[model samples]
Target chain A: MAWEARSSPTGCINLLHGDARNSTSITVFDAKGIHTYQPGWLYVPFGEQDPHKLQRSERRLLQRDIALLSGDAGNVVRIDPAAKQLQTADGQTHAYDYLVLATGSRNAPEEVSGFAEGADHFYSEKASLALEKKLANFTGGRIVTGVASVPYRCPPAPLEFTFMLEASLRDRGLRGSTEIHYVFPINRPFPIQSVSDFVAPLLEERGVQVHTFFNTETIDPEHKIVSSLEGEDLPYDLLVLAPPHKGQQVIIDSGLGDRDGWIPTDHNTLRVKGYEDANLFAVGDATDLPVSKSGSAAHYEGHVVAETIAAEVQHRPIRELYHGRVACFLETGHGQATFLWFDYEHPPKPPKPRRLWHLEKAALNTFYWQLIPPGRV
Target chain B: MAATYQIDKTVDAKGQTCPMPVVMLAKAIKDLKPGQVLAVYATDPGAKKDIPAWANKTGNTLLETVEEPGLLTFYIKKA
Candidate 1:
């Protein structure tokens, strides 16, 4: 059984389904009927992308040979890995020979006091659209954008959003009047050292206030102030935060995950640590790997998992292994972008931002559905 | 004359980009015994840095590199 959160399961199914010789039945259990291209949500508030265009029926993106269990029947309530069976919310029991958990992480605004009511975010479709309306009505004041916690999906998203927001404000003639404060929990602007070196100066040049080591402690909606654990208070007319994230609730309830709900997974093998021989694997944000939880990471891991499962089923030697490869295009605003590619052993050395890379990123967005899930690229 | 190592496996990654070239090399090298040599051919410029980094991280020995006009061939010994 394949679970859904991001595109990992879909990519895995595409590879496995393409093999005509392999007659193994593929089934996907997804409660959400629509699959959203999450990265596009960054552009939704800026009116650069329509939220509708970023989504498609999950059934349509999948291969015809695969069976899809959606709605309540697809909502997995419990996963009994010891029994090698799954129980759904619809009161149905299903057994599987191999289980791949791709149920990704979720934004947990409730983790921070008053965060859900005080802050606006672009992590979800509803939130992005809501921010769009709020941005449209904005006049000018203090606008704060930052992360509430660590290990969130799309590690570069907060930086990208900040840059784009600055550009958007300038275009709307609100740049001079508005103060953009970019906050980070860590001392650096980015997790990767080289990338931080490249970005820190850029933010400084833009006059974007940088607040490092500011872990959000609480938000006062009435006073419109965000306080940090370090005893610093920031006043803002508009608050945008990349909320704290947690793994799927079902995994936590079943005692399969850590206190934060992240599954303990083998870094090299992509297998659930203790369930290595049980034919159980965790991909994307479902695993507690020391890697960025981005769609590109998921795509690469999906490829390896597919190959590993395929080799096992064919009684062949499994050779494919995950090396924590992640590639992302960072938009630096004003129609220019930079590229980042790195693995577990190497750090990223991002080139100077260029218009060409931005165009390539736009092109990738246009062909995402065609090239990504089908593993065409 | 320098002694030459015999190639036990060859991975053609001439047209691949970042990650794929190294990914292919990793997969092919796994099938070889320790001390056996795996040859990887690539055109992606990133391979020059990535292949060696991967070898160093995985504890493999990069025996030699043959660079032509448009292609690079790397011979790595499994460690």
Candidate 2:
């Protein structure tokens, strides 16, 4: 939506989408026609099923435009952090003026052996979909949905899936028959005290069996089970795990990120730390911004970055300070939902019953579903 | 029947957010006459959700919700 509002016939706007910039053609769709877009997705019109409760096309969005193509490169060789350019495995160079590093993190299964496997399987979409098929026929058995480590992207996502799956199970009459357990490392549901404290009571209320103080260090896929780093065995017919998250090594090798592979950026201006002339910013999962790696933050950061860029364009002073702001919708079962807003100072403060912060999740999901038509948010 | 009213307001209850938007909206509409319109603009983001709920609660009409391009503009009508 930002780009759509800003881009014009004479505007120098080029959007790039896809997890890895190496192969943009197959994984993303670029729509420069003025509106919202993303990669591998597009905004399907909203209606009765529209998550935002708004009319279709009455909303703007970021849609993924994907077209599987040949001659795709598998890896990125080098990225000039300051220049915002990439050299792919096939040795092609792509450059840009303004870049949005929404390279959402990829997942790595825990030490649990063989837990996540298969040629058609993956830690992301292409792979997540494959795994979704792998678990679809799961009838009656222990299905474990949990994270392998902390500092993961979308901290509440796993919990959201738990609620979603529980609903799905009840709809299919699999609730009483199957055992659902949520295994997390944090003593409470999540690490942040504000979130954990707020959710502990709620978790018990919903009967989501909580297994705290357990971190899966290893996986035994063949046995369909997981072993905690502290020596515990959790068997499952289906293991849905939020694998360990890591930063893009490309950014690290380029000497812009920290040991964790995230760019050190000024939360206020998003200017890469320690370089004034560089004049670049990082958003989404690739940034080390002190907040949950949620797309909403990126959306917020995107607006800030765009404004800063616009200021630079006009030689005016940049006016934006990313105050570590973020909001999420906590989906409780049965048409009722909880809304939350959090950040560095506020670690997910619960919004009063009647508010819109809760709608952000559904709205954002639609924003993603419809907006990114290949790349750039 | 055409009714019109004008008012100026700004709410920055720093530590207090959320339902605050609804509260402010209520106060803004209290003196409104039938056919009169109310325009509430807030940066809190909470207003997006709260104002609509307010409309729903009072059975008033939501003429339009222009939450676009970053800024949130809500135009509401008295029931």
Candidate 3:
């Protein structure tokens, strides 16, 4: 929504987008090789091929008027009590009246032994395509999916991936010959009790073996085995792991982030903790808020932050507060999806899997492409 | 390349990157007649690929492309 607020006459705007550019299209495109793969329903809205009959549309961000700077932020130092400036890696400096740190988290594969070399990750654009190649060649084997650590982006994604993989295998006629194992660090299938209760039977019915409390300690690449911290060793022919997550290094280097690199901000106001000035706001995965680090959560946080900033600019009373809202569509194979919407006050009691939620998932992607990036909210 | 057809409207999407150029083109084409040609001038490296892909995806007819020193121009007819 940074682009939408640029037209405000309150002040001139300069938006600094970090150097890294990622496209989810790479994942969607590579999924063509897998059976029961939907293109536009995943992440990015770009349309090319529709494998699983996903809705397609023209949705993209346009930042024509917003002043943009693309580079790595080397340091963010407070120039004065009311002033802060960021120096880019290229030696350029930028001063800001209000600083919003939205630098997302990164995956740390090196934390696990052989994880960097043995397992394929679907988190990154490059790794997703690489995993697609691996998936295309696999005929039948034990496919193991596991989470390396807790508090990762999109908590339900690994579950969704596991489910989708089973669907794809069935579609390719490999279900009878292959085994699907989902290894999660948590004791239950899902964090929320209601969700776990709802999904456990469904997973059992689907024949997906759930291995809980399987905190990955190391992976023996040569033997194709994953050893958990609790002395459980699981063997797999193909391994897809969700690696440990860490906040951006720049945030840590600037002293604005905690030891693990996440910025501690007020959950409701999103204001930085130590900063004397309330102008320092943070949103998305970078914040140490007790919420799921998902794009939908970030989008909701964006609304609160945008409203707060606009109010500050217009000299109006700042009244907006974020309620830790989150909404996500869990894509279960067979052309159906379940909807989850909850907040700090409301725990998730997701509805039953329905085909309509699949449409809702598609609709959100359209909304994300059309409104989210443009700052329309 | 020289222009083969008259431009009905021009969206100077120069200095803009992916999504913006196509987004501007999408918005600009909405006001044009069905057969009217809209020209988009852009400097974003991705626009060369993104614009054509967008036109193809949206069923718009790409009439011609003109290459310049620092800018790339595409004429798309609303479909």
lDDT of 2 by residue, A221-271 (tens): 676667764346888877777777677656666776765676777778777
Which one wins on DockQ? 1
**RMSD value for candidate 3:** 24.8
Q: Model 3 clash pairs?
A: A1-A375
Please list all clashing residue pairs in model 1, or write none if there are none.
none
Q: Candidate 1's residue-wise lDDT over A1-377, tens digit each?
A: 45544334576677866752365887788887677889999999898889899988888988887888888888888988889888888999999888888889999998889899999999998999999999999999999998887768898899999999999999999999999999876555776668889999999998899987566779999999998754579999999999989998988987888768988888888989888788888898888887888889888888888888888788888888999899999999999999999998898899999999999999999999889877686
Model 1's DockQ? 0.02
Question: What is the docking quality class of candidate 3?
Answer: incorrect
Give the per-residue lDDT digits (tens) of candidate 2, residues B1-78. Answer: 112334233333222234334444554565677666777665656566656755665577877766556556566677
Candidate 1, after superposition: displacement of residue A35 in Å?
Answer: 1.4
Fnat by candidate, in order: 0.00, 0.00, 0.00
- Pick by TM-score: 1 or 3, better one: 1
Best by lDDT: 1
TM-score ranking, best first: 1, 3, 2
lDDT of 1 by residue, B42-67 (tens): 99777887678767656789988888
Evaluate model 2: give its lDDT.
0.54
Query: What local lDDT does model 3 show for residue B78?
Result: 84
Q: Score candidate 2 by TM-score against the native.
A: 0.61
